[model samples]
Structure formats: structure tokens, C-alpha cells
Target: MISLEEFKRSFKVALWFMFLTFPLLVIKVNPIERTVLWKWENMAFVGIGAFILSVLIRAFFIQKERSRNSSKNKRRFGYIGDEPLVQFILREPKYLYPLSGGVLIFALLFPALFDTYQTNIMTTALMYVVLGLGLNIVVGLAGLLDLGYVAFYLVGAYSYALLNYHFDIGFWMALPIGAMLAALFGIVLGFPVLRLRGDYLAIVTLGFGEIIRLVMENWNAFSHGPSGISNIPRPGFFGMDLSLDSAILYIYYLVVALVIITIFVVNRLQDSRLGRAWIALREDEIACQAMGIDKTKTKLTAFALGATWAGLVGVIFAAKTTFINPASFTFLESAIILSIVVLGGMGSILGVIFGALVLILLPEYLRVFSEYRMLAFGGILVVMMVFRPQGLIANVRRTYQFKKSTKGGDS
Candidate 1:
């Protein structure tokens, strides 16, 4: 029976063996030609191979070490504290909040530092941050898995597009209508699936997304089928339309303001009783019921609130892209948003923002890799999961520290 430390050291040695072998296999063997692969293909191949080998070695050695330690402890009756320690660290919001605010402010003010393409990418990333935060409320806070989230986004975009196109409505006027419609749809969907749990709920929501897309495709009279709506109106500020003449700075500020509003609303909700109810439900539904929380209303609120965020973002997305179709709101889009929530750490507001940025922007920056982009992206996700499964920013419990009260002094 080997000790844990010895097992880990042996695992590292094995990993090193595989790590040093993969490159040799790729280069010395010459089994695959570099010209046939993408510009970054060789690098990606090495990375992925190393990652797979590392995961296997770690799993094998860790399990072996655990079993060996268990047997030794059983024979000797020695105590080994295997339980994880749970601790909380308290920090002032004054410092944390201001730092986050400053980062956003810099992004708004320094649009010129990024090229036009990068600005466009940032805009897309911001849209996801909003969408991810919205989903966070339902999936993270409330523990409801939604696969039809994109339906709300599509509804919002098309709502504004059709209304503005036919009725000549302004962007601002159309936003609320889009959101309300999406919320209505959310409630409608929520009713039927109230009793369903886990995979069943996810399947139903996935079907709902498909239904919406099918309608968009086959119902050409209304949605234009494959062609989709184009020339959607852009948002205006103070009666001035934002167009090519409107600098990226204007758009950056506009998105920044929206993100701030979103963060403020989400933070407020998280501090409220409703947020507590959601968290309780997430931890255990039966327990939440025992505590007098209405599970139905809680779940519905989560759906409606999450849908509203998607709708609002849809309006902004429609305005920004200026054209959209059924193709944009696919299952993959839903998965990406969900990934952001998971990667960011569930129930964390700032974590979602950081997750969306990394997951969305990092791949775009690696566009130079072209064919290997997705491979690299997937590789990064796998690595992140293995190393930091809790998320990039694990949830930290906040506690307030104040001076202890001193009893009144004697005369």
C-alpha cells in the first residue's frame, strides 16, 4: 500500500512519460502532415493528448492512493480526516463592488483601444453576460434547468422586428412588449412542466425551442421562413439614431449601462426574500415546502424572470445585429449560455460576467487557428473542469465583521 504523496508522485512520473511521448509521436512519426492540418492543429493535438493522458493518470493514481490509504487505516484503526473543511471569508462590498465597477467603466470609456472587430465581439460578449445573468436566476439560484431559453430570445427579437417593421414602432417602445410576450410564453410553458423533474423537464424545454424554430421556418407568411427579418431598427438616444456615424464608444456605453442595470437588479433580487426562497428550493424542495415556501410560485417566478432577461437581451441583440433569423437561436446557443453559468460558478453574479467573457471572447481571439478553434475551445473547457470544477470563481460566503459590543463600564 503506497502513501497518498507517493501515489501522486508516481502519477506525475507517468504523466511526464505521456507528455514527453506525445510530441515525439506527432513530430518524429510524421504520420500526419502539418499542411493537411490547420495552422494550430499540431499545437492543439499535443495539448489535447496531454490533457487526456493527465486526467487518466490522475484518476487512476488518486483512486489507487485512496483505496490503499483506506485499507491501511482500517488495519491500524488510525484516524485520517477525509472530510472537506468548510470555511467562510468575509469581505467588504465597498472594495469588491468598486473594483468590478471600475473594470466596466474602463471598458465603456476605452472603446478606441480595441479595433472595430474587437468592439463588435465585446458587444456580443456583453449580450451573453446579460443573458447568462438572467439564466443564473432560474438555473443557478432556483435550480431549474431550462433548455428552451433561446425561445424567449427569439420571441423578443422577432417581436421588436415585426412590430417596428409593420407598425413603425420605436426600439424603446418595442422592448417591453417583447419582454412581456416572452414572459407570457414562459408561464405557459411553466404550467405543464410543474411536476416534471430533471431530464424530463429539460426534454420538454428542448422540444419547446424546436417548436419555436419550426414555426419560424414553416410559417413563412409571418416569419419569412429561411430568409428571416432584416433591417431591424437600431436603438436611439435622445432622438439621435445610432448608426455608422455613432462611434463604437456610444454603443459600448449603451451596453455598459444595460449591464450595470442588470447587475443592480440581480444583486437586489439576490438580497431579497425571493432569492432566499429560490436558494432554499435549490437545496431541497421538500425542505423548502416544510419551511412554508410556495414551490409553484417560486419556480414560476424563476422562469418568468429568466425569460424576461432573455427577452430584453433579444431586443438589444436584434438592434445590434440589425438582422436575425431562426438560425441564430439554436440549441447550441442555449448550451453556450448554460456553459457560462456553470463555468462562472452558479449563483455568482460577477462569476457569470467573467465566464461569459472567457468562454465567448477567448475563442474569437483565437480565430487565427481557424479549423482548430473549436478543438482548442473544447480543450480549455475540459481542462478548466478538471482543475477547477467548482468554477473559475468558487462561491464565497460573505460575513460582516464589526467591533464587538462592550458592556457599559461600572461607575
Candidate 2:
């Protein structure tokens, strides 16, 4: 129920939006003809849209406040894990299993249903899924903020590009080599930041990423300068010659397989001994170390393992595009990967997967809105942060309860 005051507020918001968007949305200039055209209808559209949105947003906030107050008085509150819809489904195995099966089936058949362009977009999204999961290990579970994760990504990409260009190493051979090289670089990065935490650690990682990019950009002979490396080959299937379409399909399936493997490993890691150490370290480094967890080894392992996935995807990215450039692995790329992890529930695999799809595919589909796409993107992100900062799904920890035996004997 919107009162007079709410309506007045909404009107004010609408007027502000109209003013802000007037030059861009409601006016056009023909510089060659020296004429200016004003589309008054656009102003009306903006005003109405903004008014409705503002009203709905305010209503939501009101309801949320009421709910928060009520929840405070409730003895047992709802478990705030997955988003409401996701939680509703996941709370029941009957719903969860069927949904998971349906999704897997859809993924397997996606290439068959869509064209190469769509398949390519999905491949890119899946690549980010792996990257997000990788960074999740460091930033999410391990609670180590890494702003330069793309350094390892750069290493993996350049490793394959350089190796293939000079040594004629194929994609298959370069995959493991790229991964190991990235791990080595991760260790190199880890050793220096062993004592740093929070903002200081983030700064070091950011500097490390910049350093890698600078070296790649300036080293003309080694990295081909700004021109970048081209003609990188895609992954092959048993030395078989495949058509462009066949190759695209093959890569799609390959990434799907990789995503599956990654999810499996990450899920298992969440329940393993090392995973607990990482979680404890995330909560409190001082307490975790005091409890006999080796801080040095834990941090190093987080960096190394997290980077391995980036390396893996980096190789695939180089192969997919058949081109490698320093510009492709910028700080922006790292930020986007981090955003995916953050937008998804930090330590949740399913959340990362969904976040990757939403973030990557949404932009591609919004090409029709070209000029306004980023505007919409930023608005959506702002709303998400304000409303649900925990992400699409919150990472839920496994809990156990002890039950006493009937006779008071140990059970």
C-alpha cells in the first residue's frame, strides 16, 4: 500500500531520473546538419519507468523492515542459506535430484540445440565458472583476498601461447605444463605475502598482476609486444582433423567435462581436512594457527590450488580464441572473476556456476541495449548488493548433533 508520502517520493525519484537521462535518452544531435531533436516521449517513458521502479523498491524495503523486526521475535528463524526459491527447492531431496538431473541433461544437449555462437558464449561462461571456483578457494573459503589472480591466468595463457609458438607443443601437452607453471607462479606470489593480510595482501597481489602485464607489454621480443600471439591451436581429439563446427562442439563438451570435474573436486574439498583448515583460517588466522594449523602451508596451498584452475581455463581460453594478448588478462578480468565469486555465494559451487552464467550471458544477450547495457548492469549490481549482500546462495556448513543413549551409555 503506497501512501501519499510514498507517492510523492516516487514522483521525486521519477523527476530525477528524467533529468539525469534527458540528454542521452530524450535528445539527439545531428552535428553535420547542425540540428537538435528532442524526443519528449522518451522523457515520459523514463519518468513512468523510474516512478514504478521506485515505488516497488520502496515497498520492498518496507516489507523487509517489517520482516526483520518480526524475525527478531521468532524463537526459530528460517535458515538463510540459498536464496528463497533455491532454498525451497533444495530443502527437499525429491526436488533437488530431479532439478539437478534436468540441468545436467540440458547442459549436455545445449550444443545440439544452439548454434556455434551460443555454444561459444556458454563455453566462455563455463570458463568463468572454473575461474570463479578457483578464486573461491583463495578468497571465499580461505578468506585470502587476491586481486591479481589473473596473473596466474596470464601465466597459463602465455605459457601455452609461447610454448606452442616456439616449441610447437600441442594443446594437450601444454595444458599440464601451463597448470604447473601457474602453480609455480602462485607459490612465487604466496611466499612474499605470507605475513600480509586484508588490504595489504590485496595490494601486493594487485601489484603482482600489474607487473606481469607490464612485462608482457614491454618485452617485445619475448611476448610479441602489443601485437600478441596468434594462431594458437584448439584442443585436438586423438589427432583427428575436425571442422570448425565440430571443433567448437568438441570444446564445449570438453569444458562441460572440466566443469563437472571441478565441481566434484571442490565439493569434496569442502568436506576434507584441508578444507576445514582453510575455513578456520578464513574465520581467524591467529586462532587457526594456534590450533596447530600451519598457516604457511595452508596459505601456499590455497594460492597454488586456486591458481591451478585459472591455469587450466587460461590454456583453454587461448586455444578457444586462437589468439593470446596481454590485454586479455588485465586487472579488469581479475575483477570480473572476483565479481563472479562474490555475486555467487562465496563458498558455494552451485552459486558460482549460476553467477558465471548470469554475469557472462546477460551481457551478451544485452547487446541489443548496447549503450544502456552497462547502465542496467551497474544498477542491477547495486540493487543486489543492497538487498542481498550474501550472494545468490550462501555457503552452508555441515553440522552434526550428538544424541545421548537411552541408558546413558556412550553410543
Candidate 3:
């Protein structure tokens, strides 16, 4: 509590923080009133706040880092995941099933409980959850780090939109075709780059995404030259069209069903033979090949499967918005999806739901800081990488500890 060394270190950190926050705190603009305010006092206040936060953070992290190397702490803590909250849930499916069921029950009754706006937000969150899960297959499960994943989304949306626009195809018919087209695109894109890894792979994928976007942007005949296809068919059962509230609720229920299906499918894959092959490739591609996992087949499957979900989500997005344009699908979209996969524990389904809820809904919560939302998100990603790269709710492996008897039992 009375360490001078700590104070010096904290003071240095505060100075750096002040340097970082100076621009943000020193300038304030009022768009409503059309006025600008300059206050040096605000900077001082932020500096003081930063100093305190730095001190506390330093203390906690330093102690934790030190404790990580301590055998006594390890013995005492055992597994941090074994704490009361998730201990029972992670260990036993008997408990996990009930918890999941309760959540499902609440989700089913959510629209009745909440207003339309909240329902829309929840639906948006579910869409993101699905997107995150889709990318999770490529980046999380396969460890591929795809930055062009949104290209598949665009392919799906356009496939559905163009099909419906010209042929008068309905949502149900367009959905499968859209998804299949997206998967085909995935396979086509995955073919050439099977050998690349890490940054090179990322750059190629980014280029692929940009190329697709540019094609959509410039192709005047096909995509209407960025005017986009409007009046897209709305979702309906039979010939009866739903009202606004009913439509939102319908989409909400529909996405909820899709999210469940996605979760089920992904969960099964993660536990199956192909899933094991993916993990082996992720761990060591050379070794995986030696062990008989086909690189081209596995990689293409990953891309195709991952793209399938993105395509499905794209179909839903088109129905929900009823408009399509090149601007809608961009590299930023891919970044956000990748952010969800990384911010959530990689390869964890529940973690993805949590990540989607946080990232997608956070802007709504921070509406005042709407412009700064991306800035804040980037900062959080940076801080998380620095402090806890594994993620907030990292998937933990179960370990069986065998304790040997210290003394022999007497006969």
C-alpha cells in the first residue's frame, strides 16, 4: 500500500495515458447546438482517472502474474473454472441440459415479454451469433484466420436477391440455392490458397473480399450499378403478408430457430471425426498430413461449411432489410465477424453467443458514443489481446487429477 516504486511506475503509466486521452478529452463538439468547447480541466480529470485505473490494474495483473508461477497458488486454486458458477455446468451435461433448456424457454417467450425494439435487437444479436459461429468454423476450429469471409455473405445475398428479382423465386426456394452458391464460391476461393498460412493468407483473402466487392460495385448490368436491388421479397407464410411487428417477431423466431440449428450442427461437427481432423490440422498441418488428414479436402470443407452459414445469414439479412447493395458487405463486416470469433473464446459456441451479445448490443448501450463505438471496440480488442488473449470465457479442457496416497494402508 505504501510502495514508492509502485507509485513511480503508476505515475509513468498515467502520463502515457494522458498522452493517449488528451485529444479525446480536450475537444468537445455539440452538434445540436453547433458549438465547440475546449476544456483543459477535462484533460486533468481524465489523467487523474487514468492514474487511478492504472494503479489498480497494475496491482491486480502483477499479483496475478506472480501467483501464476506459484505452486501453492496452483494447489489452492486448483482450477479457476471449478468455481461454483460454471463448475457444475461444465462438468456435467445433466446440469448443462437444464440450463440450456431454461434459456430456450426464456427465448421462446422473449418477444411476449419485451417490446418490438428489444425484439429486433435480440434478433440482430442472434444473426451475429450465427455469423460468429460460421467464422468460428474457419478461424476458430480450423485456425485458418480468414479475413474474406464476408465475401461468402455477399455471394449469398446477391444469389438470393438476383434469383428472386428476375425469376420471382420466393424466400424458401432462394435460400438453398443461395447457400449452395456461397459454398461453391468458398470451394473455388479455397482451392488456390491451401498452401499459404498466417499473414499471407490473410492478405489474399482480404484481396478476394475486395475483389468481390469491387465486382459488385462496378457491374452495372447485374447489380444495378450500386443502386442495389430494392423491393426484395419479404418473408411470409403462404400468400398472407405479416405486419411490421409480426414480421419482426417472425424473423426473430425464424433466426432463433436458425441459431439453434446452427448450434446443433456446429456442436455435432466439433465432436465428430471431421472436427478431430480439423483440430489436428490446426495444431500441426504437416503432422496432420502425415497422419492421413487430407489438406485440400479438409480446407475446402472448412471454407464451404463456414460459407454455408454466412450465406444463410445473408439470406436472412436480405429478407430483414429488403434492400441489397455493395456498401452493405465490406471488409469491415469481415473484421467485425472475426472480432466476434476472437473476442469470444475461439471454437466455443457459448462463448460466441456471449461475444455476439457484447459486441453487437454494445453500440446500442453506448448510443451516446456511437461515433466512438468502433474506437472503443478496437481498444477493447487490443486490451484483451494484451491481458487475456485466450478470451473472456475460454473453453477449458477437463483434467483428471490422480492423487497418490501419502502413506500405505495397514492390513
RMSD of each: 8.3, 4.5, 6.1
Ranking by lDDT: 2, 3, 1
Evaluate model 3: give its lDDT: 0.87
Give all candidates' CA lDDT scores.
Answer: 0.80, 0.90, 0.87
* Model 2, CA-based lDDT: 0.90
- List the candidate 1 regions with Cα displacement exceeding 4 Å: 1-90, 245-248, 398-411
Tens digits of per-residue lDDT, candidate 2, 132-226, equal 99999999999999999999999999999999999999999999999999999999999999999999999999999999998999999999988
lDDT of 3 by residue, 198-309 (tens): 8998999999999999999999899886889998877887878988889899999999999999999998898788988888888899999999889999999999999999
lDDT at position 366, candidate 3:
80
The candidate that wins on lDDT is: 2
TM-scores, all candidates, are 0.78, 0.86, 0.86
Model 3 scores worst on lDDT over the 10 consecutive residues at 73-82
Question: What is the model-wide C-alpha lDDT for candidate 1?
Answer: 0.80
lDDT string for model 1 (16-48, tens) is 655676455544433465343223455456555
